[model samples]
Target chain A: MGEDFAFWLAYLTNGKHLAFYASFRFTILAAVFGALLALVFGLLGAMARNSRFAPLRWLGTIYIMMVRGIPDVLFFLFFPLAFEQSVEWALSLSVCSAEARAGSAWPPCPAANLFFSTTEYLILACVSLGIIFGAFTANVIHGAMRAVPRGQLEAGRAYGMSEFQVLTRIHVRQMWIYALPGLSNVWLLLIKATSLLSLLQINDIVWWAGQLGSPNFLPQAGLVHGDWRWAYYTVLFVFYIFVTLGSEQVFRRLTAWARRGMPLEA
Target chain B: MGLLEAIWTDIQLLAFPALFNIYFAASSLPIGFGLAVLLALGKNSRNPVVSRLSSAYIYAFRGSPLFIQFFMFYSIMLALNPIWWRPMGIAWFAMSPLFIGPLALVMNTTAYTAEIFYGALRTVPKGELEAARAFGMSRLQVFRTVTWPNMIRVAWPAYTNEVTFLFHATALVYFTLPVIGNQKDIMNKATELFERDFNVFLHFSVAGLYFLVITMAIFFVFGLVYARMMRHMPKERQPHRPRLRFGPKYIR
Candidate 1:
């Protein structure tokens, strides 16, 4: 029993396994940065949707509608690929000869071909996540803006505040309380999506788990283990559940703090 | 090739693959709907064990990514193949993506749908329930007469949104599951086409068009049902009823 315990201890702490452990940063970074971008995009989207200008409102409608019917995975995959190719295409115009450009080939020539390292891909994945989830966040924020009491805005106006001042000081300030619940839900969805980062070639936790848990065979360590991916994935399943539990607790507290000094709704 | 012809060919190619997605959603929805109702009822039950179990099931499934759930369940089935499914001569039937795809989707959607139903369950009119109970109605009868209709009415709009999300999630099935030959879905086929021509724009847009059309179809049908359910109301006041609008409701 002691030997078995030692074997597992040594095995889990091996170099490849350490890399696996470190790869979790990719997931964490994607979730944090992706969510920040989503909030920014969402604020922009909501502001546009709420704008008086017809053209600005149309842009927001298009942005939000882009995600409405399509699966997040489709957008998640397409946006990065399309963006990479677009950049490469632009480069090809400047770098490639006319003959190379005439060829029906991607990048038009070798010079235009560019590779994205893990970090670059990670950044792309974050932006893709932002663009996809931002629509949901926009809906939540827009609704929250409307939920801000009209009287509060009126009082700000009565006190000689400009429209921008009333918006920033009164409407936006009070909107957080109403938006917190929906925003919390969006945050949960964004974190869950971080699991797909490996699909973009980012070496996230899910990728590492699959790699570490596959059957290992070698000249010296013959048949080290059979398939253990289920165990690895089970850990991930539990990890996410814990994250959700923690988020729920944190959001509950935030809601209580936000509700302070406000009269209770029946 | 003419641009329209190229699109036509691409759409025609994906036409069969699109059915695979429809199959995943169609096979899962009714079963998921039935299971969700039971789960929601279980969560609301007086029995502590039942409530705890159902609520935990909902939480676990809803909390995690469906992408991981697919891998998790598939890996478990793979591990089981040598010991159990093979021994029983059922490995082929048990491990097929066709079977497993809907199975995971049903599990995932049940949790989301149950939460919606449970929320609606709480909002059932207390007076109506009490009136039924005070009239000496049986427990089952009170639920049948007073609880079910009101819950469905209240839940219809959100339920419509859940159904659309579930349909959208069918895109993830092929990513985790092994596709046997030409059994690819829309996403799979689009990626394949993309590799051939590297036309990221055309293939994916066509794929997105298919999802958009089907989603609209779902909204239209559900709206009809919602409208029918609200027919007893006076017309003017009934606009507030939960009709499945074409635009965004809550989405995942």
Candidate 2:
């Protein structure tokens, strides 16, 4: 048992395993940035959805509808490629010389090309994830807003509070109680969605796990294993469960805090 | 090429693979639903061991990412044949990607669907069960006549969401498992074209449009069923309100 433990320690701490560490780091960072961006998008979407103007409501509705109507994996695959091409196209049009533009290829210029580094891809993944998840958040917040009692807003107005004041002081404050459950659900979903970063060629946990666990016959990598991918995937599965359970506990506490001083139903 | 001509070509290329996507979802949904019912029943069993086992199965499957589950299953199947089957006389252990892909999807969807059904089972009113008991119905009779139908009815809306997500998840199969000759799905075809012609977004857009149409069809069909099953409830109790939210509802 002692020897086995030592062997695993050496295997895991090998220089090659640095990718594993980087994968976990990037996964966490992506989730954090994605959640923050989603919050911003969600707030804006919710406000637009609730706006008095028809055009703003339409704009928000269209965004939510289009994002939600398709599979998220499709968006993850399409958005980065599409965004890169658009950037390259715009750059080629403006920056490339007339002679460079005479090429028959689509971009028509090599020098004006815009290649996305890993960081840019990560940012694009976060943005796409944010846009997809933000629609759900907007719906949750919108539903929670509607669930808030009309009398509370009336009470605020009775105190000579302005419309914006009533919205900020009463509606926004109380909506958290109702929205906590859905937002927590979205948080879990977003965490899982971060795994799609691997599809985008980002070196996330899934990518690293696939790389490390693939069958290797060469002697250079130390402790060559024959397709231990199942073992690696099992480790990933446990890690995700840990995250899920931990988040559940945290959300439970937040729900309790939100429920304080409120009625039982609320 | 012009944008219109390119998009048309992309759509033609994707048409074949889109059928496989449909096949994945179609074959899995019924099997997953049946397993979900069994799991829901097991979860509410009187025996502590059975109930705990069922809950653990649901929790483990639902908590993890489906992508990892696919990888695990693929690797396990690949390893199992050479390690366990070759020693034995069984020659059928060489599992194809075609077999393992749907197996993973069905298992994953079963977990989520079981949770939805379990939630609906818990909400089965106590008064109805007691009334059925007073009428001299056996436990089996109570379940078949009173409990099961009501559970399905209560769970239909959320189950619709599960079906939608499951259908969407079919797109992930080609990504996780190997795509043998002519076995590619819509997303696989789209990515192939995207890689072939790096600058064109038309291929991906065509694939996305196909998925959008499929999603709408799912919503329409499920909405009709929901309306029919839920017609017994009062109008106010029915979910007439539009569900604008677009995330996977399985986590709830």
Pick the lDDT winner: 1
Question: DockQ (C-alpha) of model 1?
Answer: 0.60
* Residue-by-residue lDDT tens digits, candidate 2, A1-266: 99999988998998779768867877888899999888788888999999999999999988877777678888877777888888887888888888777876666777767767789989999988888888888888888899999999999999999999999999999888888998998899999888788887788888888888888667686657888888888899899989999999999999998898877864
Candidate 2, B126-181: lDDT as tens digits: 99999999999998999999999899887887887787788788888989988778
What tier of docking accuracy does candidate 2 attain?
medium
Q: Mind listing the fnat for each candidate?
A: 0.65, 0.65
How much does each candidate deviate at the interface, measured as C-alpha RMSD after superposition?
2.4, 2.2
